[model samples]
Target: MTLGTLTWVRALDFPELLAPSTRTAIEAWVAVDPAVADAVLVTEIDPGLADTAALTEAYALPPAASANCVLVAGRREGEERVAAAVVRATTRADVNNAVKRLLDVRKASFLPMDRAVEESGMEYGGITPLGLPGRYRVLVDARIATDDPDTGPTVIIGSGVRRSKLALPGALLARAPGVEVVDGLALG
Candidate 1:
């Protein structure tokens, strides 16, 4: 499948690229949302090249075309709050203040890799907001939600597996269930 100048395979073509939970989530989403189903595209990738810097360079895509999803967690008064924050790879999630305040906790920290992977049912480097548990708050940086004239309209995000990547319009991601478009979620 091709959307504009980008080439992609139907996400259904590579089920292995998605973790079980991700597959379930995508399937459920597609069933209820035809627009998203039409918008998403997936491509196979080398797990070694899955990291943002390597993937962007290897694929010849600009750095800003990539988005990274991070899992953040915090606790307050015996209650744990978790969020999935998506930001452009060119920037960093404001976990220190913005996210901490959003989560209503004193401090927010990246969830340990092992815990993140296990809880998200995704590989450490391939966590994505699309399939996160319902308990998680999906926070998307405003920069990522808007189309940058230089970066174009689409963004490369994880496919819940290190061996594949998903591409879709930024606006479409902002419409995903439970997504919160947050200004200044990312900072230089």
Candidate 2:
């Protein structure tokens, strides 16, 4: 379907969505970059099914064919502010150890929803890595750029909506301003 024609299969507010912080961070990222403005597609679905399998099925997507952009927040060793990274769902982001070392934070952990929303202006269930503050380090999965001829060259990501998703070219996502391509960022 055309980008404009795309509709949100589901609708939910920030309170109902558990990931307000993720949504807020994404909003900040998108505000400065217009290219990612149309990349968000909202939808409503059971909150329990936020996982990849359920998300793909709800959207009628192929099996093992979904993108999981996880948001990790932590403080680096000398840094006073929290650092954030975005990674795919197929793999897990090493927030406690490896990530902490990379970010140089004494401790690393996921940011609470309230803090995420407060720092990021976007609502819950609508978080994407498109737009965010320059201080926030956005690490993207290199696999997101792999070409899949059968499914087309696009990566499906959350559109700040629980039930809906947005499809965009992997290259486009990588090219998004402030996005960093990291290999093996996620653990399958």
Candidate 3:
């Protein structure tokens, strides 16, 4: 749980520290996967430093340790489909090509910030995949979900609240709710 200039505690130990949805999801996940109990950690931080670059710089964390979750949506056959694309902070989601293809739509774009926050019930900069609605397809990039030990021991992601962040092994995060591992989900 040791990271940079931050102090991390077991996420479940302080449910009040997490967004309601995040707390519920993490609790449920832990019930089924006890192994994640200790691995899931949370640390409070200034909301102003929620951005990846700012956070890493302020906390002196490794840049690669942060992962970002972005929301993308497109309409297919008049029905709308949404996805949460997770990629390392160093890269961006392939929304124009790969995501559009996966969505089976002619176009894909980042969801509007207002709509994203309203629908997700999470703050704009703090939307994590842990508690997204079931309608959202969680897509994790291969680089972040890999079993390869050298990829990194852990990853830092949002905790469904801008005031804190969640830390856990990348492999464990890949197993969250309904994640689909896509090899080219991200563009370097």
Best by lDDT: 3
Model 2, position 26: C-alpha lDDT score? 45
What's the residue-level lDDT of 186 in candidate 3?
92
After superposition, which runs of candidate 1 have C-alpha atoms over 4 Å from their true positions? 1-6
**Model 2 segments beyond 4 Å from truth?**
2-51, 148-152
> What clash pairs does model 1 have?
none
In model 1, what is the error at residue 42, expressed in angstroms?
Answer: 0.4
In candidate 3, which residue ranges exceed 4 Å CA deviation? 147-151
lDDT score for residue 31 of model 1: 87
Per-candidate TM-score against the hidden true structure: 0.94, 0.66, 0.95
lDDT, model 1? 0.86
Which has the greatest TM-score? 3
Q: Write the per-residue lDDT of candidate 2 for residues 32-136, one digit (tens) a residue.
A: 765454554344456555566766565466533456655566554455555545555555776766567666767777778776655655444545564445567
User: Candidate 3, residues 1-188: lDDT per residue as tens digits?
Assistant: 57898989999998877888889889899889887889999999999999999999999988778899999999988999899999988889999998888889999999999998988888978899999988999999988875334337688889888999999888889888789888899998
Q: Evaluate all candidate structures by whole-model CA lDDT and list the values in order.
A: 0.86, 0.57, 0.88
Worst ten-residue run, lDDT, model 1? 1-10
Better of 1 and 2 by TM-score: 1
Q: How many residue pairs clash in each candidate?
A: 0, 19, 0
